[model samples]
Target: MTQYRNVILLALAQACFLATSMTMVTFAGLAGIAAAPDPKYATLPVTLSIVSTALTTAPMSIIMQRTSRRFGFRLGAAIGVLSALMMTYAVYSGSFILLCVGALMVGPFQSSAQYYRFAAAESVPADKSSRAISFVLIGGLVASFFVPTLWRFFGDLFEGVDYMGAFVFAAVVVACVFIPVAFLRPLEEAFDVGSDNAKEEDARPMGAIVRQPGFIVAVVNAALGYAMMSFVMTATPLAMEICRIGEASPEVIQQHVIAMFLPSLFTGFLIQRFGLFSILLVGHMAFAVAFMTALSGIEVMHFSVALIALGLGWNFCFVGGTTLLTRVHTQAEKGRVQGLNEFLVFSTTGVASFAAGLILNLYGWQTVNQAAFVMLVIASAITLVWGMAGQLRARRGRL
Candidate 1:
């Protein structure tokens, strides 16, 4: 198959798998269960999925190195189905801890999910890489349609069902992932095993890359954009729940998440129209708009619009940042650099997710948004400074 067609098919299948897993995993929005005795603990299931991916993403990527994309993707799909089943059983049996275990398993599957975008990005021509990443992300846009809507549709699929119907629906979706795998042509990947040179290059003394203006800026833009977004976005559902503004915070989150991915539909087009760096500016601006809207009045309507804007904002910054950063490294450096990059990226998010409860408990939602705003400022500053410096250097060379 041609490279572009490969990306389209893989992205679509990945989106389907995600739509299922994401719907099943996002359970905190159920009004009945959420009003249960311990409401503060309502989001543990979703947290479980995020935390698992953070801890195991590196290992999952490494394993995929030794194996092909098909094996890893299929394995993850299988695990996801089983996890959904286990979760359903956990709910049926009313075992909270067992439900946690099921959520934990969902993480590895998410880590596997990250590969679809990266894999799709790599298979394309260099000029089209950004568009490729955006294409895979567009799958997320489809998730926007399916996740919240499915949450509602399935929630009522069975009477008095909190999230059980959603889980069953998710299992079916995850199981269907294998169908695409049957046709997925294993694209050549540099991260595959026996990649010693790749590892060594990635292992370049941390100080070296840290000193490189380009490397520092790239990593900072990607990691910080991600970290700051998670910090606030992670806190969003909790804030909404605590404030009692919405009975369906999970459903609201699904909408916000959808908004975040929806921009993927247009980001690539914008990148082609404007430059990659220019798109980053738009993303940063969108983030500011989202923050303002989120904090505008603390009402649910404002909050939803703001959160959705934030998601889309993040989608642009992170997608653009990652797309640009890939150009800063060579093929030999792909595995380690990508690995190191992701390690830092996920690590920051790990800290953000873990700290969300603590931060929210200590400070109110407004404070949480304020902290995120400051972090956003720092991230945007780095990109701006780097762009200016690059311009100056180019002019000096011309002179």
Candidate 2:
């Protein structure tokens, strides 16, 4: 129980972090619409937020390595609070540029929050790492429930100021992150082969580490899985609008968000029981089914089912990929490896999100789903080959 204290606190911190994010996602676009000079740039604030996250991910990871996770997280929480206040001021002043700047400032918080799962994994023994990762993600599930209520209670708290009070609420939520984080105990060092100096000496070059088949597969599943999820999820509302089911979009998206994090409740247990490769294969199949279902129809039922499948697929692949990554790096290499992994994952996600709108508008929803399907097939094939090669190597060793 004592050993698990950090995990519990981290989970609480994750919930607070995600609640702030969900609030921003819910209100940022509407605020942008009100403040922007041109209607076309209404989503620019959201885009800038993701861009800021991607740019800072690697640097934040390195910073945590030099300092400590507690320090880094507190710094991120401070940044989130400041950014939320800036956004509040932006709404009050109706300044589009200031809103964008505030959105950009929030990225470090997102980047830092992403490490909660990794930190959870670090809190537990290696065999239980998958469970720790999944448990931390349950925080997102909690946030999905918490955000709507928060809005209902405070949506109009500032009277004439529109979303100004909501942004203030976001700041308060982020500031609350300080409480649980302040209690987090320091994480133990990763297991290494020898003395600390020898461990440092044994660290492989980045190129050499990334060249490993395991590393490549981990990145493919995590990065491409995230990209596909973002691409499809982002396009869903727009696609529904075209299909004349736009009114149902919110319910469908709500269900999709629920599907995404609900499975974290048991995903780690499934991984522990059935193994990573099998779960990953199921994730690939889920994506395939999702794309096919979307292609088959545009009805509300079809959209709901497709998005649900998409979310489930993302959970499996993302969790599996993260677990796999932990097995590949040495203690000395943890910081750079995790940093590079995050950088690639979010970079692809940022590109996929930005492209989703363009591709859907230009080629239609069918084409967007088809492109994602094609990418998934390519990534799945690479993963399959890697898994089989790993089995063959084990067989040869036995012989």
Candidate 3:
């Protein structure tokens, strides 16, 4: 555990990041509705935030590769602080355009935060990678439980301005990320540009690396799984608004957030016990359950159950996929592979988030759930093929 000191600090940083994220996720859509000219554009701010994240992920990864993670993380926290202030002003002014811009500015911060799990993985031995990743994610669980109370306390600070103080609270929380980041020790595998070891572990061409079966499986599960999760989650606040349960949206989202991270407590252990493919399969099944429950009704219970399942599904697929990804890359290829992987994952996520609003407005909640099926099928098929191929190889090796 002492050796995991860096992992613990990274987790603290993750907690700060998630607290800010939860505040935004809980309030941003409602804020968008208040600011947007039309109801249909209510999720535009949220979508833009994801878009910004997608755009910055690869660049941030590359930047971290060249610089230290400590430097990169501090830079991200500073950006988050600025973005949070921009959002506070946006809310205060009721300016939809400014809100969108603020959300876009939040991308780089989120892009940096997303690497916390990867950094944790790199800090530990290969066998302990999954547990380290899970431990860092436990920060989200802590954030999920506390952020709402913090928001409520801050939300009341400015009497006339609705969520203005909450954004301020977000800024403060984001700034707190710097505290943990300050103490983060350099990772064991930190890239050194001119080192003999670095030169010897020469990276393969991007195409060759991405073409591996393990890489394909990893990306498919993580990318499509995240896309599906974003698709439904981005639309959820609006769906609740449509159902006239707007006031309950926060509680539902909180429950979903909790569900998303609580499983981290034992997910790494489950993966070790059940095997990666089994966990991925279960994740897909959980997603199926979420869609079916969502389609079954529009009541608060329906929303709660569906979102909980969605969170669980996301946890399983994302964790398993990330663990699988670590196996397919050398230390030299880490930056390129991780950068490309995140670029693809968040790119799809951005698309899903944007489309969630359009689809929810045009077709309805049912269509949003229905559309996710296509991605789920693709993810499941590839996972199945990969699992079977591994089994065949093992059998042949035994012969």
After superposing all C-alphas onto the true structure, candidate 2 shows an RMSD in angstroms of: 4.0
Model 3 has an lDDT value of 0.86
What is the Cα-based lDDT of residue 182 in candidate 2?
80
TM-score of each: 0.82, 0.82, 0.89
User: Which of 1 and 3 is the better model by TM-score?
Assistant: 3
TM-score attained by model 3: 0.89
Q: Residue by residue across 228-325, what tens digits does model 2's lDDT show?
A: 98788777766776688765665666677788788778777888999888889999999998899999988999999999999999989998998899
TM-score, candidate number 2: 0.82
Give the whole-model CA lDDT for all candidates, comma-separated: 0.71, 0.82, 0.86
Residues 164-239, model 3: lDDT tens digits = 8779998998998888777666652345433355543488888888889999999999999899998998889889
Each candidate's clash count: 1, 0, 0
Query: Under the 3 Å rule for N, CA and C atoms, how many clashes does model 1 have?
Result: 1
Model 1 residue 302 CA deviation (Å) reads 0.7
Name the lDDT value of residue 316 in candidate 1.
82
Give residue 360's error in model 3 in angstroms. Answer: 0.9
